[model samples]
Every structure is written in C-alpha cells, then in structure tokens.
Target chain A: MSVFVTVGTTKFDNLINTVTKYSAIKAFQDLGYNRLVLQTGAGKIQKELDQLEELDKFTVEHYDFKPSITEDIESASLVISHAGAGSILETLGAKKPLLVVINEDLMGNHQLELAYQLYRDQHLYYCECSTFVETLKSSDFTKLKPFPDKKPKLFVDYLDNLLGFK
Target chain B: MDSELGVIAVLIAVVVCLVPIFSIYFSVNRTCKTKNPNVTSTKRTKPASVMIIAGSGGHTKEILSLVSSLGSHYSPRFYVIANTDKMSQQKIEALEAEKIKISNKMEYSIHTIPRSREVRQSWLTTVLSTAYATLYSFPLVFRLKPEVILCNGPGTCIPLCMAGLVLKIFGRDLKIVYAESICRVETLSLSGKILYYVADSLLVQWPSLHQKYPGSTYIGRLV
Candidate 1:
C-alpha cells in the first residue's frame, strides 16, 4: 500500500525531514506500506529524498505540487499531511486515515487548535515534528471516526427560512 | 449683529451635515440591534439576488462549497474578490460550470476590489486601503442590491459588509451573513470578530465560538 504525505502549498522542511528518516521508513514498512508519495510543496529536500529513493528500501515518489491531489489522496491507504484546513477536510471527506503534523514554525497557532480539536473528537491523529516518528509507529489508524458528510442543506435551509422562502 | 449672524450660519451648516450622519449611524445601529435571525419578511415567490464575497485560498474554498450547495432559487449571484486574488475567479467558474451542467440556467458576475491589507502592510496603509475599498464597493452594492450578502473569514468581507450597511441606511432590506471558518475552533478570525456585530446572521462551525459569543449561532459545519 502507498502512504501519501502532503504539505499543501506551503513549505514544511521539518515534516519532510522527519518522514524521510530511516526509522520512519522502517515504521512504514512494518505497517505494510511499501510506497511513499510525497507532495513537498516549497520545501527544499530533494537531495535527501533522492538519496532515500536510491536506497530502495521503499518506493519514494516526490513532487513539488499538482493542480489537484485528489487522485493521489483517493488511492492512498494512509495520508500524512500538514495541518492545513483544506488538506484536513479533504482527507477526512475522502474517509482516509489522516495523521496531521502541526507546523510550529508558522506564525499562528490556529492550525494547532484545529488539529487538537479534531484529535479530541477522535477524527484524526496529530503530533509535532519532535514526536511524529513515534506517533507514526504507535498510532492505530483504524480508530479514527469518519467525519460527518458535508451538509450544505443545513445552511441552505437556514437561509431559505431566514429569507421567508419556506 | 453681523458676528451673531455668522455664528448662526456656521451652526446651521454643522447641524445639517451632522443630521444625515447621525441618521445613517442610527439606522445601521438599529439593524445591528435587531439580531433576530428568524424575523420573516414579506413572502416572495421569486428567486432572491445574492452577493458572495470570496477571499483567497481557504476562504474562497469554504465559501464556494457553501454556495455550491445552494439551489437555483438563489440566483443572479454576484461574486466580489480582491483584484490580486488569481485563484478565486477560476474556482468560481468551475463551480458555475458544474452547476450549468446540471441545470443550464446560471446567472453570475465577478467583480474585483482592492485588497484591504496585504501581508506585512503597515497599519496606516491598511486603514487607507480599507477606506478605499469601502468606497469602491459602495456603487457595486447599490446597483446589485442583493437580498443576501454571504461571506466567511476574509478581510475583503468587511468593506462589502460596510457597503451593505450603506444600502440598509438607504431604506433597502439587505442581509449580511458571516460564517466563521471551520479552522477556527477556539477563537474567531479578525474578519469574524469585526463582522459579528454588523452581520445579520453570524454562524460558527464549532461550539466553542458559539459558547464564547452568545450572539453567533452554532451551525455545526456548513462547509
């Protein structure tokens, strides 16, 4: 199975480095995932990624970005992502097991709040760069609760009622 | 006697100007005081016009997703975006195209306004730009006179909502609905904070925000 790692449209060099570590690769292999698909965005870690790929311990595919990562997200058995709301929602919407890595270097800690809240709700697993490897090795993906389906009707009905349409 | 007449003239001029200013202020304030979301108006069988404020990136995504769920009854949609925003127009078109494939009757327009504040901009420049944007949005809001104005956590929404308030002061029924972004679990964003008092309906995705601000309604994840 393949594990997709996306950093959205921002650079997360620390996340990239942590996931490419030898121990992390071994953890993935132990979990029966032999391929790694990484969307690196603006992170400058190509040299390390290349060396990791050459080792051939696992298949490593890396790209800066794509117009849409929906296809990759759909096919992945697991997803490791930066704590961007768009990425988090898309992964949960796809019903994949998501482990969000909070980028502490970013100016605001709002992403941390989102990640922690979702984690509290048992929807996903989240950790900092320091604990990413250990969390990966120990977290059970099967325990995540499925996010509720998008209910656009709620707002529509609310608006309609407010506007006296009903 | 001439000096007294000069003073009287100045006083009259001040009163005349302040009368309209205070009138406008009190009208807008009255709209804010009436926070009842369920207050129904005249029943209308026709579709209502809507003006949507689309911010860059995540804000644009969330607002459009909310718009896509809307049925055709909310028609002639007008989208306002920052002129520097390159992605929102494309996303809006894609969404409209998908809608057209399903129903074929789509009426929408896109307008661009100046960014209220670019990243790292000085507070002084932000104030100037915000004023300029509010002036720029006034005519657009006046002409469209959309029944509903919908926005999420975008800086651009402030000016548009201000323009909507202008419309309300002119004796038009305009509703401004502000939805806090889902990412905001504990606190509201800057735009959300400002629009809380001005918007007709304030929606929060998480329960914490609703608990913190009793005025905002907890809608439970509309996006």
Candidate 2:
C-alpha cells in the first residue's frame, strides 16, 4: 500500500512531528509501503527534513514546491492536505478520498470557515493539525473511494449549457 | 437665443464655482484617512503592506483597478510589470496618477522588462521565457518585501508571483492572493488553478469561477 500525502507548504513535517516522536517515525519504516509526505511549500517549512534513518518504511521525498494542484494530484492513492479547498476538488477529480488537516485552529483560525463549510456540505473529512496523523495514518486507504459522484453533479455541464450559446 | 445663452451662462457659473470645490472636497475626503496608512481593514489581521503584480494590458488594468479599494483597506503599493500593449501602458500610467492625485497616495512602483510576446509555441521559448520571467521577478519581490501579494492573472502575474509563493514557504511572511479574472469565466486558467493550489487565499470575481475553483473564495468584483 502506498500513501502519498501532499499538504501544500510542506509543513506537514510539523504535523507529523506533532503526532509522533523520532521514535514513531520508526514504525512506518517497517510497513513496506512507499510512504512519504511531499513537502508542498514553495519553501517555507522547516529546515532539516532529516532522513528518518530510523523509519525505513516511508521514503520522504522532498519535491520542489510546484503550486499546480492538478500536477500534484496525479496518481496518488490518498490525498492529505491542509484543508485548503483546492486539494478538496483535485482529490474529487481524481476520485480519491481526502484527509484534510486544517491550520485554522492551528495557526489563526482562518480555515475554520471553509473547513466547516465543507464539513457541513458533507463533501470532505477534516482533522485539526494536532490529530491529523492519528486520523490519517489509521484511515483504511486500501478501501478509499471517491465520494459518490452522486446526484448528477453537473457543475461543468451546467456552466457549458448556460454559456455555450452566448 | 438670449434665454438659452442665459441658461448656458448660469450652468457655466455653476461649474466655475463647483469645480474647485469638488476637487477640494475630494482631496479632503481622500486625505482624511490616508495620512495614517495603517488604518486597518477587515480583510486580514492587520493593515498589510500589499504588492499587486500584473502583466501589461488588461491584466495590468485589472490589477490597478483594485489599488484604490486595496489602498483604502491597506497601505497598498502597486507593482506592475509593463505588459506590451500600448493601451495597457497608457492606462496603467494614467491610473497610477489617478491613484496618487486622489489620496496623495504615492506608494506606486512600475517596472517594464521587455514583455515576452512572452508565451511560446516551441518548448524552448516556453522554457526560456519561463526561466526569464522567473529570474526577472525575484529581485522585484524581495525589494518590495510586502506582507501580501495579489496576482491579477494572464501571462505576467504567475512568473514573479509564483516565485514569491516559493519564497514565502522559506519563511518570508508574505501572504499570496490570486484574483482570477473574468476572461476566465469559460475556462479556468491553468495559472489560476495553480494559484488556487498555492495561495494563502484565492479570489474570483465571478461566481462561476468560484464554482470552477470551489477551493477558492470569491471576493467582490474588481473595478
């Protein structure tokens, strides 16, 4: 099983730090899946993405921060994010379930509005930064499926039909 | 004819009396708040020093369009990369003046680095211009050192602005905001979506763009 976590701004390193010590970074090493968090920040996160010489299960690949979400979403089994709305839709497009970690409460509560809206809309699942790893690492990603494209969600079609003639 | 002349004379008299008075009123109204640049806005936590970057023509115009409102909201510094269109150049210059004359607000900056025809057909030109644009904007962003940067899209904004996003990640306290344009009403531009992925906040003037980038927040129309 491969888990690709891309929370733009690579500070997911901070989130992972919050979850487990340098010790727990060991357990994932033994799991035998290509586990890694693509630090998505343009450059602002922590300094040393030191090798988890201890946890060999995940190969933490530090991808240069490219802001294109479409490119980021390509071929990922699970999408983990900072509850930014862009990630939500891209994950939906790829038909993958998302694990969102919100910085609203972690940083300044700016995300609470959007995160709450999505939560209420029942379109996504969110965890605060503090509990993100616990919630994310435990997700049954093997069974992950896109939230049903239920009820003829014709967003693009509706726009096309309205604007096509004009 | 005399009556008509008399009416015209009266209108002229009114205009003669009102012109300077209106100007004075406008001056006073604009200055009353601007003398203190930090007259905070409800948009963000504090009154941010903002840099709004855009390409030459429509993109530049659209970016300038927001300056007045943004200035009213923050200590806005307009940074424009002169797009090639003459109309864009003239209008942006004109708007820059208007921005200054009204509020006595003079925090405007303009830079024109040979607009690329900048997009390319061949991969080489694309890569070269992309590289050039990226290299070009690096110094501009560092020099301005704004707390927040807004991009009004087309070709010009992404280069300098995207680099700024990368800088912010490295611990620059810059907040990146992208205002996707109306031209994108039909197709959400790839640049806009990329901004959606990276921006601290993404804004769209139209509701459809908002729907397209459901991840974005819709701020009101720009101009």
Candidate 3:
C-alpha cells in the first residue's frame, strides 16, 4: 500500500488530467501498489473527478473530512503539498523530503518564495502547482540532501536572547 | 488643636520632602541596576516567559529551529497573527495545526485579520484590517504575559510586539528581541529593520548585519 497523500481538492483533477497515463499514481498502480489514500473531502469535485476515477484499480480511500487524516500523512515517504509555507515546514519536520505544489494566490509570489528558499537551502524540492504531475514523477526522493552538519549560529543568538547565556 | 495642626503641616512637609529624595534614590538605584555586575544579587530571578512570533514564511521555519534549540529552559509560546483572508487563515491554520505536536510545554495559537488581496482602492481596507489585527491580539499577549518577546517578521510581529513593548513599560521589566534573517532580499521588508529601534536584542543570521547595525549582534545563520 504505497499511499500517496493527495489532497483531494477539486484542483487535483486538473493536475491529474495533465498526467495522461504516466502519472505517479498510474506508475504506483502498475508497480502492484495496493492502496493510495486521498486525504481530502469528497464533494469538492464537481464532475471533474471522473477522469481520475479511471485509476480506481488502486484502492481509493477518501478521508472525507480533513481531521480524519491525522495518520494518512504517516503513509508516504514523500509528501505532496500545496505551496503553503506551513505545509512545507511540516513535511520537513516529519523528516520526509517533499514535493511542494504551491498555491498561486498568497503574498503575491510567496509560494515561490518558500519553495525557492527551501530548494536553495537544500531542504525540499519545489515545483509549480500547474505542473503537479511532472513535479511528482521527477521527484528524486532517495537523493534528497540532508540538513547542514552543524546548527545555524543565529540559533545560538536565539538561545542567548531567550536565556541570556553568559 | 493649633499645635496639632502645625504638627500635621510639619508631618506633611516631611513626607513631601522625603518623597522626592526617595524618587531620586530609586532612580539612581534603577540606573545602577542596569550596569554590568561582577557578581549578581541574591534576588530570585523569574524565568522569562518567551513568545516566538512569526508568520507563514521562512521566518516561521527558522523560528521552529530556535524553539527546539532553546529547549527546556524557555517555557515558550507561538503566535502567527498575520494579514490575510479567512480562507488563507484556514489553510495556514490547517497546516499549522497539523504540524504542531500537542505538548505540555508548547502552546500554539494564530490570529488572522481579514484583508482583500486587491491593492487598489483598498487603502482603507488595509488600515481597517491592520486595526482589527491589533485590536484582537491583545488578550492573547495578556494571557501569555511573556517576559521576553521574540519576533520574526512580516507584519505578524508588529501588533504582538507593540503589546510587548507596552508590557515592558507598564510591567516595568520586559525585553523585545527581533530575529533578523540572513538574507535581505526584500527591501522595505518587515525583516530588514522593522523593530531595530525597540529591540533589546537584534540577532542576524548573516554577518553583514554586523556592519549594517553595528550595535546588533551577528549570530550567524538560523535554520
């Protein structure tokens, strides 16, 4: 059950339909993967999800409410998330390398800012929300870079600020 | 009765004279207290209740690292409290609530002010939104009652830290610290120097800030 936590929002179909046949979902199905859990609400898709219904061979589980997904996140080695900054940080803290698909409408160009910041810092991989399929398929999980050898020093200053270290 | 009234007047005079002397003495005492002491007094020091404030950005990411490093001693809290719409707040909150591990020591809360993304004809919109944000965030700060407030920027820090400064003045002892990021990519950004004047401690990830704010400490890179 190689579960991919797909946020089952309506926009997912747009990204999925772009896959044609070579999507990561299709690839996992071909590889005899058992189940893929969609961590999202069901009624959000308005006739748009039928195309995605073609891949029903991969047992689909819908966490109808967002809260039910307290544990579906634990299923994947890689997290696919909207380019929300909070999501990116959570995925990193979970110690899983992420494939970040950004929200287009926050802080003008903030999703890009976060992705580039993490990508530049070697924390995670960033890609456009428009190209979700391409991003996930090409996501090189095993080759993800680790955090720096030593902690960043401003951390020491933070400690000094909080504790006033002598 | 005449003698008693004169005694009363004399007593009032003595109290008035002593009050100024006491005020000057306390003033001098406070001045001396701020100076670096070779040996500390036996005063029972209260631990600083630190609040790390940041928005949904790299600023938040770096603050998380410090929260971990500062570890057990700093009993801390978090505040997002930003300028965004309700929908944006839901998304950020959902992501944050998902990320925050419920802990005995770590308490998390967020405040969002409703604002339109549209810029034109929205000058009034921004001012009202900013006012709303400031108005709601006071109780959060009051309840937490942090002794030291550390801010990571982008409009998120302003309201809470302003409250923190007020706490400093009225509460008679609180410090405001600003975490300066290594990169200065955004000009007129909330990060570059927003709280420079008020910050008791200004920590920078990059050494360049050392030259920029010679008074500021360059603490190297943050996470």
Please, what is the TM-score per model? 0.88, 0.43, 0.57
- What is the per-residue lDDT of model 2 for residues A1-166, given as tens digits with 9 covering 90 to 100? 4445566533555554543354334434434445555644654434455543545445565554663656546656556666554455457657766667776435643234445554554656678766664665565545544454422213222212222211
lDDT, model 3, position A26: 72
- When 1 and 2 are scored with lDDT, the better candidate is 1
- Please list the C-alpha lDDT of all candidates, in the order they appear: 0.83, 0.53, 0.52
Candidate 2 lDDT score at position B157: 62
How close to the true structure is residue A83 of candidate 3, measured as C-alpha lDDT? 57
Per-residue lDDT tens digits for candidate 3, residues B89-156, read 45445544544554433344554543211223233343444445555555566557776687766555
Candidate 1 per-residue lDDT over residues A127-149, each given as its tens digit: 88889889998899898899999
Instruction: Using DockQ, rank the candidates from best to worst.
Output: 1, 3, 2
Instruction: Give the root-mean-square deviation of each candidate in angstroms.
Output: 8.3, 20.7, 13.6
**Model 3: CAPRI class:** incorrect
- lDDT by residue (tens digit), candidate 1, B1-223: 3323332432343344345544766666544333433336756567889999998998999999999999888888999999999899999999999988878886899999988766555555556666667667766776788889999956678767877876676567678999899988998876777778789999999998899999999877887
